[model samples]
Target: MIDAGSSGSRVHVYRFNYCKEEPQLEEEVLFHMIKPGLSSYKDDPVAAAHSLDDLMTRAVKMVPEELQYCTPIAVKATAGLRLLGKDLSDKILNQVRSHLTENYPFPISANDGIQIMEGSDEGVYAWITVNYLLGKLKPSQRGNSAAIFDLGGASTQIVFEPVFSTPSEKMSDGDHHYRLDYGKGDPYSLYQHSYLGFGLNEARKHIKERMVDQWMDDAIKTGRVYHPCLPANHNETISYTSKATTTTNSQPEPIDIQLIGTGAGATQCRAVIEKLFGKDRPCPTSPCAFDGVYQPPLTDTFKLRDLYVFSYFFDLTQPLGMPLEFSVAEFGALTSHVCDGTADDLLKHVPGAWTSLQSAPDTCLDLTYAYSLLKTGYDMAPERLVKTAQKIGGVETGWCLGASIAMLDGNQLCKA
Candidate 1:
């Protein structure tokens, strides 16, 4: 199974036990990832499909050569492809299908093999994966399951079995409720939603656009514009086309602007990023999550249930030597320490913490946004315990495993 995510694409080669009544994940034979997701090659669909060649080669080697012809392979793209619009997404998927059929040894099972997954489905898959690993997927364990919070580049998702009763009217909305039937004793009803423009990268883009608008206005009056979220020594050229401003012909024109950071620590950084959460957006639902999105109150359901946060959340936490499970206060303290230092200071203090210089500039901003998302967006208290990790019990904590499981389960459920 291949997961074409926003930031990257990953392939999971699995060996399952079909002898049992229900297929089990016997072994994850191989796993690999490549940067710049298939969606990055939106303009060139063929190249996007070809990007999987190296990963497919590794997959071929991992599976038994004799069994390769019978093995099923699939590619499911997430928010990245969804953001590309239907025409481009279909073109990319078609290219992937052609490449796999013509070049790969695996069986292309059906017409629906390669497709774009809905945001809610993505969340449900991750939830299934974590619960399956945690021994919570059995029919007897229906009520006991962990809530999943996945933070990606282009989107974020939340999925869990709400403890409180959902109104019949609300449950009728397909986006709010999803039924998962694994051809088992009983099906599971999940509350899930995928919020676009809320992921780490998209949030950064929104925040940067706001900064550019203010900076450009200030630069006209003053000679300089300062960015509080970046390091004091950080200097970079940023280009953006403002929605508030357009050319005389009403077409948006890109403008390149210079940014000089003024070392404004966590407090200021949090203030700037907090604006992107859209807290003041009108809420038709009495209890909304953010930007008037209907979400079951997390106060009662999330607090009582086990919560697992992964993806970018784990990436940011792991580099700081933080525990896999920690409270919001501990997370805040760590972000505070990170905010107090410049890029040089961070490098000097936490040697090898950062993998790239490009990521270093936004360390403070990223950490601050994470903290705010928990506190302001989700209303998580400082002492609420949230588990964050890249893997659980030697298996990657992502949607790929769950996708494989769904595929083996005959793809009857989770059609969305």
Candidate 2:
């Protein structure tokens, strides 16, 4: 099967040497990753082709023993495809197809496997992961209302599913959380959706604009020339959060999610939140930690997702690309936030924990500037800033997970 992902294309030969008639496993083994591949295309089809050729060689080399002749290559493309124009996309697809069919003895087509899923695909994946993790926290009915936000490299997502009994009929992934990404891989089960446009960097930029916009409104309302938010009046940097599009889904029941997070950069976001909005209580009350998929009373009918599950990850398609290694384990750590020992806390637990500012110097300045502005202008309570950061961090992660969930929601997984 082909996995066209944000980074590149991955080919998987599922049933290598299995006998079609006997249905017996042979010496042939399954393929997971075909590396050195065309994972990202910045719209250069020629460049992409070069990467694909290198990756194909890598795949051919990875075949173990006698399986090389038996296994059929299921080629797929993912994130990098979106960058190409229609002409280029078609050209690339045709090129890949021809190359595979001409070269591989047991050649596979890209469209033969799962591709082109919907928003719900990812939503289902998010729901499944949420349920799995929540199961660790509590034993309850699987189907219940849960909201999600997912920040991804290519896009962002927000999803809301009301209370319902887990279907006796299950999806193909078998877990529940659906995968949303199309043109390549299968959907995962977990929580909800991944909003595409509003990830961390973009969201942060949006937040900065929003803060200025709000500052103008506040100044107009209060009628003060030296508006608290204005640099002319004050040099304080106010904190801001990435706001989201409101959900319209009715709340059938609270999912009471256990807060499962996936993807890298989540912990970094949590740190940013703590910096801007930690509680000022001298006497320690709650230990320094990130909040779970928290629920706040905002509207009457539907509410936001229970927790944040992802981070504002930069798109891998960019020239510089996403920072740090994005891994499931790293993401798993973010979602596993609790009052007890966690790496985020462990990293910054002691007196020097908060002092670890070596990662991003510019970010430190931004944080400081934002914090000063908010504190001086809005008279924002110290605790409120901490709370806001926690919420923002959660929301950012939640949106990403939500997007991933949507990608996996409506798969023909039962067939799997």
TM-score, per-candidate, Cα-based: 0.91, 0.40
Q: Could you say which candidate leads in lDDT?
A: 1
Off by over 4 Å in 2: 8-43, 65-80, 83-85, 109-150, 158-161, 164-194, 200-357, 361-416
Q: Any idea how many clashes model 2 has?
A: 101
Residue lDDT tens for model 2, 286-400: 2211111121111311232243333332221111221233333332332333112243454453343334323332232233323332232123333331111112312221212
Models, CA RMSD each:
3.7, 15.8
**Model number with the top TM-score:** 1
lDDT of 1 by residue, 1-416 (tens): 99998888999988777766767777788889999899899999999999999899999899877778777888999999999999999999999999999998887756357999888878998998999888888777778899989889999998888766554433335457888886477678788888887999989877766777666777544434578888887887767776645889999877666777877888888888878878899877656778777777777665667888899999888876678899988888878877877444555555566554356888888888888888888778888899987878778888888888877744322111
Worst 10 residues of 2 by lDDT: 254-263
Q: Model 1 Cα displacement at 216 (Å)?
A: 4.2
